[model samples]
Target: MAAVWQQVLAVDARYNAYRTSNFPQFRTQYIRRRSQLLRENAKGGFDPLLRRQYLKLRSQLLAQRYGPLSEQSSFRAYSNSIRSSRTTLDRMEDFDDDLRAQGARGHRRSVSRGSYQLQAQMNRATYEDKSPGSVVPTSVAEASRAMAGDTTLSENYAFAGMCHIFDQHVDKEVPKVQFANDDKNRLACCSLDGTVSIFQLVPTPPAVLRVLRGHSRGVTDFAWSISNDVIVTTSLDATMRIWATEDGKCIREIPDPDCSEVLCCTFQPMNNNLTVVGNSRQNVHVMNISTGKKVKGGSSKLTGHVLSLSFDSPGRILWAGDDRGSIFSFIFDMATGKLTKAKRLVVSEGSSITSISARSWISREARDPSLLVNACVNKLLLYRVVDNEGTLQLKRTFEIQQNSSPVHSIFCPLMSFRQGACVVTGSEDMCVYFFDVERATKAIVNKLQGHSAAVLDVSFNCDESLLASSDARGMVIIWRREQK
Candidate 1:
């Protein structure tokens, strides 16, 4: 019996010792290739410039081998792609109610601020929300039929939900909310508090990542740089400050002591290094971002205060909407990088122009028309850019429920629909309306309602999958489609 036990113990000991001894060898063998690759990458012996050239050559070779898609096929593919990729992703609205309550209690009681951790509790709101005027389907088949029903704007869009009020941070209204074209997850809002706040969206409710504070007065207008790295903002403080979004630091500040206020700002389409800004006065200053000074021969003038501006990338024109409902077109010279006055068209006699959104070049120049949408007082007028002469002809007029956002308020003048299929703007009646410009009649599609007060500004994210709208009362709501 003792010999039998000794034999079993000896066998077990041998098995354990062998397993332990071979483990490191097994791991080394499995990870040897990965270790070699890491060492090679870390050695810094490879030339990045040569690698880039090699990549370019490899891409050219691949393109030559595969060839380019036919023009017709490319157009068809792009148009179909605009329908949006199918996404099972849904939004959970009011996801932070419980979190807000818990945070309130923590603030009142004795506990760490960490006790207010609200992220884990929040959730996405499911189901499609029909807007106030949208037709609601009766059944599943009806819903399908409704979705396939019309080119009408309402059927295409549904209100996803509202944004969690970060009103605790500031008392002023949020005028402009521009989504970073480069980063879909980020939203930048210019407030009257003299601070530009950037919010990160992703996990249910959005979290305020950083508050870019620099302007002594209110930040009226701002935009994401073409590269999406910097945020450019114009303020009543008489300065246009560019902020690095990643670190929340002001990279450059262009001040105009010669003028009272820098009211509007936009990055040049061809030359992003050049920033085109319109002041409260007659002058429009185009500055060099690198040196933080106005570019030589870049300064131009308008008869009235420049209320809003848009860039025509294809035509190389800068379009400015003045206070008296006049459209001013400035020829942007690529060679000299200067803006020279092209033409001016006055649309309304006394109505003040609030906002202007420029449309891209017509793909099928004969079939498709390039439009410049301008909002004056409560009416939105669509003008077609006729020719190289920068001649604009009146096309369509849309009547919104009179916008009440302050005339100087960035939100008041223009409804934002830069990278989307339809034109969207809010009315004083607290309704969001979408106009289908593709339609011959410019048919009204949807009248979305969620805000209780007048909505100030509306902006769509890169893919137009998500929309963020600000109101005159300092509330912001983000909407997503029920389904992809």
Candidate 2:
């Protein structure tokens, strides 16, 4: 036993010396050879011992050359090799362990190291690996730790730490608004310069495809119909224009009845041809767009001046938020032209409602139901509609406080089909925050910062593969998940 231990120690010492002296050359040769092998055997065919030796040698060489450029390439190659080796080892060891435990003798004896210790080392190495191609087991805690250690995540968090300075740019105090189409293929942004820019995204390199100029005054709000072909925009000039999305042609201009400033307008998701427009008078009017005529429906006046509105498809409920910090829900009967009261829920004490949006489709209790998410000036509220004796009632309120700046826009999208539910919120503080709603806490999963001005709008694609954000400076940024 003493002689055996001595032989092991001598082998290790000689290996260390060889690594120190010729490791860089060995690593370069090994990488080039392995890359050629990988190309030949596309699935990667490498002996276990050779793979381990390569990994050990590469790690030593990488540690020796520790700098930005050197570390980047070495880490990348090491990560790819480890991932391929892990997969090969896992597949080869699949049924061998069970067979050995069943009293069947294998070709080689079992190693002395404990399984738990080996697993623990693997976990640690996975956590420490920062390369893009690192392979990790599918564990929630491990995935979270890996994400936390990502450099991109750290940079974004640092950027979000900056607080928003209201009136930061008095000269460029132009209010900006942005909205994403139903399909999220395009994003339309309007600024105070009487310019409405439409960005086409789906392609490899996204670019601005069309610029619509019909509003003489600053555009306040706009909504894309469910079809995504027509867009209606309202301005401070008390005029609303409907434009064709393909060519940016103004189809019709709907003048206000009393010349009251059109605060907001949205297309009814359930009724494609009808649109509901709200003004400073706290009244809601439904109009038929095809005929350009009012739908012969009487307007419903809520408590305070209307600020924003959203719809919940599951409950067929329309929520109207007002300046008095109150939110009212009404159910409309299109055939009878009647409106039924659902519930009057108060959101905040002094803060007015700014924006409202519904969480995209979600699967709950094996049924797909849409959730209603609302954003007040200083708070974020979420409520679920429950069926109680055939009446829809707001069930719960999950509140998130904004300490630095007011919550200007809140967007909740199902980021991952495997992960339960996630939401991203952008505030006037020029910061974008990500939260996992299934956790039911304000634990920030990630943050993004690029816009120097206030972030006005945020939306995610249908597949949740990309996130698009627009700020007050007419800048639009699209973020996509880095593929491994």
Candidate 3:
């Protein structure tokens, strides 16, 4: 071991002279040789400086090629928020775009001066006689009373409105009936015989205006436009026809894509040019009345065949009842007449939702929380729409237990001149039943018997002054408030 150590020390002493500063020529030549060797290295190709530059250029190119498009909304907003380095003109354009987006999201219909005047006139006309203790009734009210005759309504019930059949439906099925908005005296009805009957509702007898004939099959339901100039009818023949109500001329017959037999339909809340129809397949579809084109995107389908439905404009929601006793709701687009965001709930086991009445349509309903009434099987359900978000909360139910069997799907909700709340629907027996809507007790208040057969449909005028019903035998009856 001592010999090995001595040999290693002798070899280190031999290189000590080369490592010293005195060998300046040797140090210079050695450095040049090492540099040349490093330049020709086989392992790592680029130096750190060159590698960093390459990486920077590559990243720039990739970003330019695959980055988000500036035209998209989210990207534009984000770029604008971070683009202090961009030109002022560019930033201004982004700001304007954001403003336009906000405007679109919060778009609302404009009210003109003419509309305001019309609204004021309507309010005055509606309240002229009913506001307070006026000695005499409005001429219209008095005329209504004289026309329908009077009966003293029960304490809990409002006017019993007289009941009389205007015309017998040739077909056995009851027709769907509706009174026009601008003129409550104008009643439009759908017949099973592929015809629509227009009648003037006054003077103890309703005179026929015009009979509209276009549907190849029986008509199911129809709606009077807000202007009361047009009537839209959905038929079992898989077409919805628009008619000029004044002359009873068919304007157009819009075809259903599925031809699945439209069971029901109604007009869009704000637009008279839009109509929505529900089919036997439990699907809802929208069409442009002016163009007769099916709306492309917005619509919904339910799990059951839609029998009845109603629209709530402010809530941007629609409710529909189907044959399976299911009520489905969806968010509605007022501008485009489309339906989306659907939810379904089965309310009854087997009964179809026969009728739907929104709160505003009800007489003297609470306006804060929107309300809707559904007549299912033998019961009436009141659902309160929460926060104008189409959320339905069961507020109350009115029913007749046992021995009642099933009632007609018709419900007529009315607010009386005295502010009484009442709802009327048909019973399996040859009678019409009235219940107090504001009460939770659910007792039968009155039963008006006039129809020899099942009363299939009922509607009340703007006021509780009159009630109209249709029976299985195609009899249309008008019931007027009883005189005190």
RMSD to native for every prediction?
Answer: 21.9, 18.8, 31.8
Q: How many backbone clashes does candidate 3 have?
A: 7
Q: What is the lDDT of candidate 2?
A: 0.51
The superposed Cα distance between candidate 1 and the true structure at residue 275, in angstroms, equals 0.5
TM-scores across all candidates? 0.64, 0.59, 0.63
**Which residue runs of candidate 3 sit more than 4 Å off their true CA positions?**
1-163, 313-315, 361-365, 368-376, 400-420
- Considering summed lDDT, which 10 consecutive residues are worst modelled in model 1? 83-92
Write model 2 residue lDDT over 1-484, tens digit each, in one string: 2112222222232223234454543432333233334333423444655645655665465445552223223322332333223222222132223324544553443432223333443333311322222122122222223223333322322322322122322333233334454355666666666667777665746667788897777677777765467788877787778888889999998876547677677776656566777777777666667766656653677766666777654225667777666777777675643556667766665456666665443221112132344455444555544432122234334444444332344444322222334456666667676754455454566778777766666666644456666666655666765543
lDDT of 3 by residue, 112-231 (tens): 432343234323332222323221223333212322233222552545556455774644555577777524576867778788888887765667788999889988889887657788
Angstrom error of the Cα, residue 16, model 2: value is 70
After TM-score superposition, the amount by which residue 362's alpha carbon in candidate 2 deviates from its true location, in angstroms, is 2.8
Cα lDDT for residue 285, model 3?
Answer: 81
- Model 1 lDDT per residue over 360-415, tens place: 31111111234445455576666666655466777666777664353221111111
The Cα error of candidate 1 at residue 126, in Å, is 42
- Clash count of each predicted structure: 11, 0, 7
- Candidate 1 has a TM-score of 0.64
The model with the greater TM-score, 1 or 3, is 1
